[model samples]
Target: MRLAMLDLDSYLLRAFLTVAEIGTVNGAAVKLNRTQAAVSMQIRKLEELVGVTLFSRSSKGLELTSHGQIMLAYAREMVALSDEVGKRLTGKMIEDRIRLGVVEDFAAGHLIDILSAFRAQNPKVEIDIIVEPNRRLAKLFEDRKLDLVVCDITCLSRKPTLIWTEYLMWTVRSDFVADTEKPLPIIMFEEECPWTLPTIAALSQRNVKWKTACVASTLVAMATAVRVGIGIAPMMLTTKPEGCRTLDRSADLPGPVRIEIGLYAQPETAEGARYLVDFISRHTAILSS
Candidate 1:
């Protein structure tokens, strides 16, 4: 006797993968823009077709079953290939344009290299990039003026497609000395910058006297200020300027700080936007490092 072959639906595979990644039907439904009932029905259908339970519920929510663990890899590949095929067949990918917004720190760091690699693979896809402060980027994203954005997560209210934790340190010129008796000289971005309030709050909570030494409109200007021995500023570890050093624990300053940066995109964005989002998500670790 001959065995029948199963035909898997791409839609169902996508639904399964989203739910697995998000770990809840409700969350997946919101991400997929489907009703909760529809996503639940799709998961049931996928489980039935596979003849194995995909998820086991616990107090923490859905946990993948052993079978689901095995299926996850294959589902990801299939869904990606399916999307690739659709894009290739329609020939719309080459004509697609993606408007992307990013915070200045990322733009000054590994963003160019990442974009270069992406452009090599997607040569014809036009990318218009806006480099701005996180608050401005978040506003642009909220207004739907950009297809995707990478900014400080604290500035945005929505769940990000991907998140990276960046370690921030109190940075100062290599030869700079602190006078404990005087108000600490501090470098700061404009008041609307996402880092400004937290930086001030941290100083205030520590009861450290601080006075603004330089008010910079951009990261480069801030770095220049630090290099010129203007004041101490919070800077990401991975992107600290060459002439600066982080304040040690013995220094009378806030302890080490961490901030979340995220890539944001709406679920209904265009394929080019989704492709860029996926590309960025895949290389997040390298970008952050």
Candidate 2:
């Protein structure tokens, strides 16, 4: 029996994923080093082959169709696997050492997966990855302890290479509900956490009384506190711990607020550091989804 040719072209998958990531065909074109018209044609060809409208265009740019969303996960996994195979076969992957820092916004398991993927492709690279709060990471980066960092910061002295805007919602224990008689119980980062004051201000603005249940040193400890009936705490959608969900925020609680994740790197950073920055940026686009 003869093997049938696959209808889904890898190039088209590349084009589709690029467009999905960048939110525009023209942007995808620039990223893929293809002309805008060529990128559009490939997208059309892909839709024809797949028999689904993959994107909806608008003034803001392109949004994925429902079908496109369904297709995206599979496309990304398949493309990632193919790329890994290519790297293994080429045996020419770069090798270097770098100190990288990431904010505690990532789910612990998800952060491992991200780093594992990078390590698998470039086995000889030495990575010293530190997971900490943005405040600490920013300070470390400034002190030259970190070569590259992906973190959320309220302000930066220099522009970031890329940024992702997100929102934080109040997350609470599975069975815990606010008691009006008592101040709301909560767990959060260290005192210097930029959100701590804003969280207080938001609740105070509405006369929602709250108290600091605990200021955990690590994200894990903070999450553990939230898991065990601690008061509501703000967390990014992607990083909420198990058995906890975003509160409805209808009961005088603060709603979600905008946050920014940024990639900062030294201009003279090692190749490994630069590659890790790009790697994190590409994978983090859909983090809050």
Candidate 3:
């Protein structure tokens, strides 16, 4: 027959992805509203179906096997597709406003894909986006002017969920060279720019001399300054700009601190905002370490 109708239980895939996301059977169990035994059984079923172990257990936590990592991608697409199809067929929609604030770095990249995916699942959801530095966004969050925020470690006081621990790197224009004899010339953002404090602290700790050559008030200005060889700037390793080159350790610059990108949700329904968070956490590499 038609290859036995080509079937695998989607619930097992959900269990697998959930376990991978939360990092523990117990955590996944609580999130999925299933018993520990039930979650274990589903994982076992999934492993058997795939003929490979999906997770390797350790005292630290469950780690995804290589096969598990590959499966996670397709698994998420399948789940999102299933959810989208069901929502579309049901024609049940929520038109609530979703006020979202995100860091400029993210707002320029896969944030579009993330929001598009969210809109696909939530057709009637009204999305209002505010793009700014994490410092400003944190203020909006505190004032209850926004429903959700994706920001850096400065706002960790909000007890937000950790998205990723991204490393920082020094970036310069392709042809520029570091000034070995003088204090390192630097391009920084506004005083409230989150990257500024950590970068300065790092250079200070290592006794690496640096001076702010330009304080760009916006990302475009910062990038433009770099393009014209104004000065080196600190940027997230994951979001390194295409035209700029990351400096090597030989440059004698102190390594920048790792930053934890996080998410905050308002106490109320925050319905559409929650959907965006789940989409990023599950669907994008934004949350990856």
Candidate 4:
């Protein structure tokens, strides 16, 4: 019965916590890297299995019914526990190796400061910092190949907590302007970019069509394309590339596209896990404030 009740994936638990954090099936889908349909079905299945209505649709988004809210807290705790187990079981013992992965966007931003402080705090811990695509980074985390990742909070991710949200902006060359007919010539990271969904959604809302003219898997490639007028891209407001200028659409742009940067660790090792989480929490104040 226990085996039947909770599959290793804990899809129901993830779905519940994701809905609570993002406030919509679509949003949860992005974090989970699943389709909206898939997320909806998962939620439905979870609700059916548990025999409770977890959420109610709202104009703002999805609001948790009181029952949903109560369950959400429990679900989050369970998921965190699972991740802690993974963290503890994988890799060398805690003091020996601390493998950290981060998205390139943060390489130029506050990551350096954070790492520097971390090293100062834990002088004996060996840290390996890997810069990779968002998807790849998350995969490493899931595979227990990485101890922690400092990357944009992707909709597909179920492990990360909401650290902070960053404003999204469209960065284009100074001389670049969109033509009336063509969808913007987009230069994007090859399928692994985390913010790709928001970009697509914003364009869809504006009735602007777009095509990926170039696909480079790295931030540098995408930035180069934007600099040379390949296409405009939505970038984090906190960290903009050197030459790119913000584009003004004269209307409300898609949003304060919130980019959440978070940390992940195995759930079973609360002592070590809490240490890493607390480390991030302390330095994360700079971003939020």
Per-prediction CA RMSD (Å): 5.4, 6.8, 5.3, 11.6
Ranking by TM-score: 1, 3, 2, 4
Model 4, global lDDT: 0.68
Q: State the local distance difference test value for candidate 1.
A: 0.82
- Put the candidates in lDDT order, highest first: 1, 3, 2, 4
In Å, residue 82's CA in model 4 sits off its true spot by 28
How many pairs of residues collide in model 2? Answer: 1
Number of backbone collisions per candidate, in order? 0, 1, 0, 15
lDDT of 3 by residue, 1-289 (tens): 5435546678988898778867889988988899999999999998877778889988868888999888887777777667767767998675778888888877876477768767886778888899988888998989998888889867657445435666667889989888767988888768767777777787877788888899988767877888888898877554666678988876367776566777777645454665565577675564453
- Candidate 1's displacement at residue 281, Å, is 1.3
lDDT of candidate 2? 0.76
Q: Write model 4 residue lDDT over 70-168, tens digit each, in one string.
A: 676566666666765776688433454667787777776766676677667556567778888777887887888876677666633564554566666
The prediction achieving the highest TM-score against the true structure is: 1
Model 3 off-target regions past 4 Å? 1-89, 237-242, 286-289
State each model's CA lDDT, in order. 0.82, 0.76, 0.76, 0.68
Q: Is candidate 2 or candidate 4 better by lDDT?
A: 2
TM-score of each: 0.75, 0.63, 0.67, 0.59
Top model by lDDT, which number?
A: 1
